[model samples]
Target chain A: MTEEGQSEIFQKMWSRKGFRAELRAASAIAIKQWKVELSYPLSVLWFIIMPFIWFIPYLIAGTALTGSSESIHLQDLTGISDWLSYIAIGTAFTGLALSLLWGSGFALRREQNVGTLETLMTTPMNRETLVWGSTLHNLQHGGLGVILQLGASVLIFGVSLNVWGILPALAIIGLSIIAMQGVIFAVVCIVLTAKQGWMIVEFLSSILMLVAPMTYPIAVLPPILQYVSVASPLTWTVEGFRGFLMYGLAYEGVITAVIALIILDVIFVIVGTLLFRATERLVRQRGALSQF
Target chain B: MTETIQEPSTKSVESDMAYLTDFKPRIMDWSAARVFATKNLKIAIRYPANFLVWGVLPILWFAPFILMATAIAGPSTSTHFTNISGFDDFVQFSVIGWFVFMYLDNSIWGIGNNFRWEQFSGTLEPLFTAPVPRISILLGAAFSDSIQGTLQAIIMLIFAMFLFGVEYAITAIFPTVLILLIMVFALYGFGFMVAGLILVFKDPSVLTQLIAESTYMLSPIQYPVQALPKSVQAIAYVIPTTIGIITVREIAINGTMSLPAFVQSIGALGFLALIFWGLGMLSFKWAEKWTKERGHMGGF
Candidate 1:
């Protein structure tokens, strides 16, 4: 209430003890979410099946149009002769990207719907703590789903994966998830301020799919979109991922992709964090946290 | 002091009993439907971003199919696709398919999720308690979804026409509209069935996506049914949208179909529409009764 009291509270919030408390809070939130999700086993089953659901139409249409599994043009564009593997990998990654994007992007909205956002905001935990917890939950959930989905694809569709590429692919996935958290943080900022923020998330998801070469080579995109894709961390992740797993490209070949993703990770994370904190503070001052 | 309550006279009690027995509930209430429809329309229009997103989303969805098709075939056309589909313009074929797919998507997300969403928002129980026919609300939601889907599809179609240089036959518009109307009803039946499933299950997204994606793969959305395997094609024909989309393509895109085939397609779709609508209504009524008896209507 007093000036000195307020200053002390701020100092305490920034202390090392406060950071540990935030970490614990984030872990608790994530575990709570997992408990809620695990209670719905059917929903979990559907989540695993969803990647296949989305991929089938693309495979069917591609095969029908090309009259076979192999595409000469696709080979020419991406240096991969197997269209099945290309599409399977892309679909699997898209599934992961969408899960993370929608998961963390709507994390705050979900809390609000459950009537907990206002209650949680009253605590001493950092706003980023809540976001981080949701993002961490999504990362694990999505990562597991991708593994199962890809495994099923390989078994059912006869698609092959480079066994040795697993470690590097996981590393790239780790980097991409971190980079994507930045995007989700910015989305959370919008969610805090707007009623139709999910619409923006949907729009962004589509834009990401369009730009990230999810189903086709980047070379197929127009020059402008190609430039945009090059700048996106997701594009680099997908490129680096496919480079190792699909094309058997070595570490040396994918160094540029690795470097690009690292730079993008730093940029997006910093910008996303600053923007989210600013937006969170603005919404609090405007007394709009509970409006929705 | 203890309060004393007086009992009503026998005559008054008889009159109250008569009040309950005298009134008959209608099978469908058009006035309530108008209210529901108007409310849904107002709610939708209040958020213009929904419309913007709806308009743009189809194009965004269509991009992958187009890009992948181009990557597989060629930029302008694919001879293999043309051979089977009887049309070289994948863009036009895909655009038309995407238009139909939009209605399917809307019906699932909109009409299918209608009751489930109401339950989530804590309004379904109140709505059920009201003295209105349930079918009226379903119809109202269906009407709203149709209006929104049609507008969104038109926007997407116009964009595709200009962006991809797709052209349609002017004379085929009448047939296309007729087939579309039939397809819409069949889809309405599908949506109503999904709505019932959601009512009983109380899990909307997974169920909706399951039905949507299954139908999408089964039906000839972006490709001809001929392109599918023989066994799969047989199954595809049984799907309501399959005949409707194939017939529309024949009339609109390929511009040729024998008179017998045309008649067969129409008759088959008409039969499917009846079957789906009848089954959907029955299932929904059964689900409502089942949930109500179990005291699960307000449990969401």
Candidate 2:
């Protein structure tokens, strides 16, 4: 095709000229994922139950250490007296962080394993549609999983949460989710380029969990490590989520976290898209795109 | 022409199995197990990555908790931990659990996954058909995993001693070993049970993961069993590791084992191991027959 024709096509597909097709492409990918995942009903159930699995370690730790969830010393460190509720909220949010870390990248890899990656890559669809679809699929499962995890933790374990803070917490979480999308795109770029295995996934997830106070309160980390935590969007998300929903801290305190998350969102979108696009172009040039 | 092409492979396999079956063992059947143990050790040495991660990842897993405990209690640490655990050090308390947790993980998840890994690599069937007693292969696998895990555990223990200032006692080693032998025997049975289930179900990844997480809760790996609810502690008591861990912790911290507790735990561990190993053998036999009837042994 001529250069002019290529420009016109790109504009049409990405810009307002071809918005409808882009939406349709994304929706189709999401539907395909939903169908494929739901076929493995056991796997779906496992994911839904995953947060409960994640919670047990900390729950046991709290019980074993203090013989109760409330820790006066921990409260001095983190401003939360009830460790159970705090951990419940933290685990709920960490699910989002982990799903974003693992889900987006694995979607592409899973396709390659099933012999659909080549077709998906070569199809006449906007590239953004794939990212959008992956995000949609992860959020569908991850969001529902978090809600159920938190709900069960509350009902069964009696984790006391400030129910009224739901809307404000969700808005802050929205910013965090957008930031995570960028972060996941960058991760997918590495996956596509390096062809590393699950250990790399483990390394990445572990690093993110370490930097973020997802389970452990960030206050407990040394000042240097606490400073480093700011590098991850999850740190902001966890702080904001806890401050709003669990601690019932004033919204003013959480505003700082919200602002920090939005800044991360912007940086991640810019850097992540560039990194992803660069990796995509390199793979196309090298024709490694066809190989898993 | 077809018979000529197929005859050699059929004869070769028959001869191999016949050789394995014909070999007579002395009263001590240690030589057969030695053969497998050596094979397992070679594999561990050659592709140490699978085994090395067990050593490395536990330190990484344990580090955060240690840091957190230090942060929470600071210089003096949790009085509750010292009072309940009989040790004033929270850092040592959690690290002890982490170390025990690593050993249990190596036995249960590591050895159990060996079954799944063999299937995925298309080696399970041939191994099963080998004329050697199937028990030898499992015994060898369990032994190798434990040896590899022991190396990791030592490294972790040293790291914990240095990093957390844990009091290392030479005298505790003898008793710790005594506890570990019984503990490992029971864990091998648990591993065999998992391997048997995977043979039947073909996918116990989720089930194993659940067991892994639940075991952390039920085993008192990170917390004392007494701290849990009475009902939960009752459940925890049934798990062999829970008893083994409590016994070892007592020995390690206080330099003495509770005699009655040790005896009770050892007896329980022996009974559980025998029951689980028996069930594992039966399950394998049933699964082998079922798969042969269906011709799905080779179809992972």
Candidate 3:
């Protein structure tokens, strides 16, 4: 056999080994982050306790105030008698939206700050596997807090899952979250390029929560601002969740939401991946990885 | 002989005068404060892209809500608050409330997170070692945050007005601005306390998500405080942002403010500000002492 042909075969053999090594390293990093989160049980507790604290007042207030009013009209337009259920769903989804943003956007920065980014990069690990591992770790750690909060919602708000196809609604919400991974990735890239730490991301995430229709429906927003909310993933997620939980998941609107989720996920992931790869190269050239 | 004796006394008096001049300005250390603030400001603005991302992104953040609101409720539709005191216009109410919130969140987080970045850049120790007081360093950071936040709020308000067709009364603008300023300072004081905690705990990010989520829920950003139950309303009354939101709503929408409400709002804000400032200063001093003792002043 020719030397060139033999070398090509050897390269292919090494690539397989490299891929396996990368996968292992990424998993290790993800587990490490998860362990760190578990170490702080109080943080998890706060996440659980906060939602209950927020919703109880609304539940009590709704019951008391709506008693005098005709038919428990909590909102101006919509006649939602079950204000607890309405706010409970809103709060749950809002918590979910927050978990996605915080988990993905700051996950990379956290690893980088802890001096793990360079270690992982130097290994035979591929960036995609590392991202997946980090994302998975984020889901596990953040998911624990979210589940705890959900449990609190059930306990405090007395939320009853009566709607059919609730699981599919949750599945859609999960997909929408996964799609938001792209935006989170984009935010991480910006964080890397700016190197100003996580304050910018923190501010952006909070502002997004307020601007998005997480608590109140978009019917409450004015004309132009309503158009703006449509651009956010949170709106789709919230609307999709509410549509399924409140109005039986049989609406055609769910299809539009599913399609939009897929499109947004593809767009965000592709663009975010490209931006991240380019930023990684820039960081490498600047030798910033070691410095941080 | 008398003239010759007068010369020494005159020379002594001149030296004393010079000494007093030097001591007088130390009363405030305004120059040191300015330099400290300017350095941080330059760092924040050094990266134009970052400045735009941090400073201008909040406006874009409002875009999604704008789209959703318009889609659900047509542009011509107005939101009415029957339970609240004087906020008939939903768009205007949301705009002002969000503006205040955006400003508070920016300034508070900016001040609180300054230490983490300083640690990353290997500058925290030097900053701590500087002759200027720690308060000056914090004040400088807070000032930069205020500048960025104020600019963002103005841009956001303009976008909200034009996009939402929000009508504003100039007469109410001044009082609204006053309430906003009080709320900002009061909130910044709370932010300083958190920043102090960051210095001591070394894990401020742990509280970041919790703080961010709770404040928004607690504040009356989109809805009226009265919409909340009596228990929640009591809690909201204690929160500085509630006062700010209610005052702004009353002035801008109703074109009137009850004297009792105005006094209550200002009084609550003032009390909170004083409490936060006192606690923040104490915590800051303790953190400084602890860091210096442990020799971790420079260690990020």
Candidate 3 or 1, higher DockQ? 1
* Per-residue lDDT of B192 in model 3: 80
Name the candidate that leads on DockQ: 1
TM-score of each: 0.89, 0.87, 0.73
The predicted structure with the larger lDDT, 1 or 3, is: 1
Instruction: Give stretches of model 1 more than 4 Å off.
Output: A1-25, A122-125, A249-252, B1-22, B116-123, B130-132
Determine which window of 10 residues in candidate 1 chain B has minimal summed lDDT: B203-212
- For candidate 3, what is the DockQ-based docking class? incorrect
DockQ of 2: 0.45
Residue B122 of model 2 has an lDDT of: 93
Q: Which ten residues in a row have the lowest lDDT in candidate 2 chain B?
A: B67-76
- For B61-81, candidate 3 gives per-residue lDDT tens digits of 545434333333333223333
Q: Candidate 2 A-chain TM? A: 0.89
Q: Pick the candidate with the highest TM-score.
A: 1
Greater-lDDT candidate between 2 and 3:
2
Is model 2 an incorrect, acceptable, medium or high docking prediction? acceptable
Off by over 4 Å in 2: A1-20, A67-69, A247-249, A290-292, B1-37, B49-52, B64-76
lDDT of each: 0.83, 0.75, 0.67
| Per-residue lDDT value at B157 in model 1 | 83
Tell me the native contact fraction for each prediction.
0.75, 0.39, 0.04
Candidate that scores best on lDDT: 1
